[model samples]
Target: MPTSAAHVPEPGEGDGPEPWPQGISRRATMRISDVLRALRTEFPHVSHSKLRFLEEQGLIETVRTPAGYRQYSPADVERLRYVLVEQRDHYLPLKVIKDRLAALDTGTETEAPVPRLATADGDAGAASARRRYTVEALAAAGGVDRSLVDGLVEAGVLRPTTGGQLDAHALDVVVLAAGLAEHGIEPRHLRTLRTAADRHVSLVQQVVAPWRSQQTASARAHADTLATEIGELCARLHTVFVRQGVDDLTR
Candidate 1:
């Protein structure tokens, strides 16, 4: 009679802590979708385009299979997570983030707290969420005359809420319009931006519509996450395009 064989657990199976589950530990590399699934729990808004953008920015490294499929190791996922967390929590720009990453790679700095930029009043980011303004307050905050605010309202650039109040973002729009006005770009000329913003919003809604239609709490939450993520991504892309166009003019 042959002896009975003892049971053996496969890699990432049974007992020990599995940071990389679902047989990912056994695999040499994870596909983009696999990486997305692993990250979605913590970053519901992380998208394929975001990963590609990070790669293009030289922030993340990946291997390409013979067939051109991108392969990510566990380390790559960790590094990408670090980058995203720094951006989300610390509000650090990519240049600073990249510099920190470089320091880590060169063994110049260990994992430690970095100095953060702060406004005199406190965390402006947190404060801005609770800050609302009347039209007069908005004009004062923007350092613009009430006439500019009136012109912006007439041009449909600065729309107040139903409660007749403006949010922090309205102040930013007012200030930007005022600056543009100095350069002969009037608030009326900024109407195109409002129109473009609406179209971008419509695009985000269309992309998340199926998820939102599911009517489940999880699906609705996911849709909300996607909307926020895609909106920010669109804004970043627009900034990059504008910068590139400006660079071309200088060239």
Candidate 2:
């Protein structure tokens, strides 16, 4: 029963769905059963309660008919699809997804991955579930040579688990390094970035240390959210600084 920061009026609670961008419509025509049928082929776990919960979280909007039946429009269905895809493929928290959706509505650049429909085989368009990968598998996934991964491991740019498997985080690093490799940057050049990331993580942890130290569930949850927010802000600030530096170089 998580609440959303976005303001979505409950059925019979408010006037109607909020205004959206051009080309978006909220006219209710399909029933909840129709929506379920539309979604369940790809999202097998969707249910009435799950949809209700997402509505409660303000991820989707539903209109009530004169008989008080909940009705969904095509736009609503697409929005639900986006939510489900993000959750299944990216493991994004609802807060982040909701914020992205709101930004989309306002014509803001969300910087989040675009929501894509699942493939015919029900796979999430090769954006599969997060899992660990061996060095060979990681290299294959990144379309890079195994030696590059080995070099990253040697240079402390990638840390494998004690079981010798690299987690999803390592895969991202490998993929980025592979792209940077096209620019002649090597694994050794990534050490500074890794060191800077560690410093940022330490700073975020220090800021949330008090709440994390509390032995209560609420406190721990608050600390986790605070950590994520602070971490994102730090990353954005870093990006701005880098862009500024690049601008100066170009000038």
Candidate 3:
């Protein structure tokens, strides 16, 4: 089955009623059942036949071992999370999710909307003066070390452009990471945050993906409303989870 949920073992996954398998570390390969348990939270309707159907439908692929048991990688889990989240949240047919995934596989971020969990205070779509930063400028502004910046890239925490320049979002996240570092958390520890953020985007995609269809204007407006509303809901859930953790700790 699937491996672990929350991508990398959240604050207290193991204490749950349906804890994932013991002795199966995050770095270890996992079976299909493992994948299902990991996914059941976000996609409660998931089932064995459904996963097999996805395989049959060619939405997701898995490698088999000597006995032909499915083995999945972290990347595979991330892809499955994307597919399931999209299908459940958007009521998207597998065909559309598969195409969007294929587009992502081809380094097509230009076509993919930047996935943000919270709508910002200002009009994010409104025009503003463009800005770019050299690594040094980014390091100074983000209040991170030059070596830490390179480490962020190595840890898959940052994505530089084709010309190797940092984007505004890059600075924003790095600066946020620096703020977290005040409590001694490292950038490396934040990879799970990025993965969870992608899953949130998958939720928005469910509402927004259909709008791109040559559908009616009314349908497009519905997509816009759902995206913003659902995105806010997801962000609220994240806050609630953090509050729960704090409650558990301080008591």
lDDT scores of the candidates, listed in order: 0.71, 0.74, 0.63
Backbone clash pairs for candidate 2 read none
State the lDDT at 43 in candidate 2.
71
Candidate 3 TM-score versus the reference: 0.44
Pick the lDDT winner. 2
TM per prediction = 0.54, 0.57, 0.44
**What residue runs in model 2 are displaced by over 4 Å at the alpha carbon?**
1-129
Arrange candidates by TM-score, descending: 2, 1, 3
Tell me the deviation in Å of residue 107 in model 3. Answer: 51
Model 1 residue 16 distance off true place after TM-score fit, in angstroms: 12
Model 2 lDDT tens row, 59-162: 87676766777887666777888777766656567799898888776667445444443234555533244467999999998888999999999999999889
Task: Give a tens-digit lDDT track for model 3, residues 135-215.
Answer: 778898777798777767777788788888877678777877778878988878888888888899898897688774735
Candidate 1 has an lDDT of 0.71
Alpha-carbon shift of residue 206 in model 3 (angstroms):
1.8
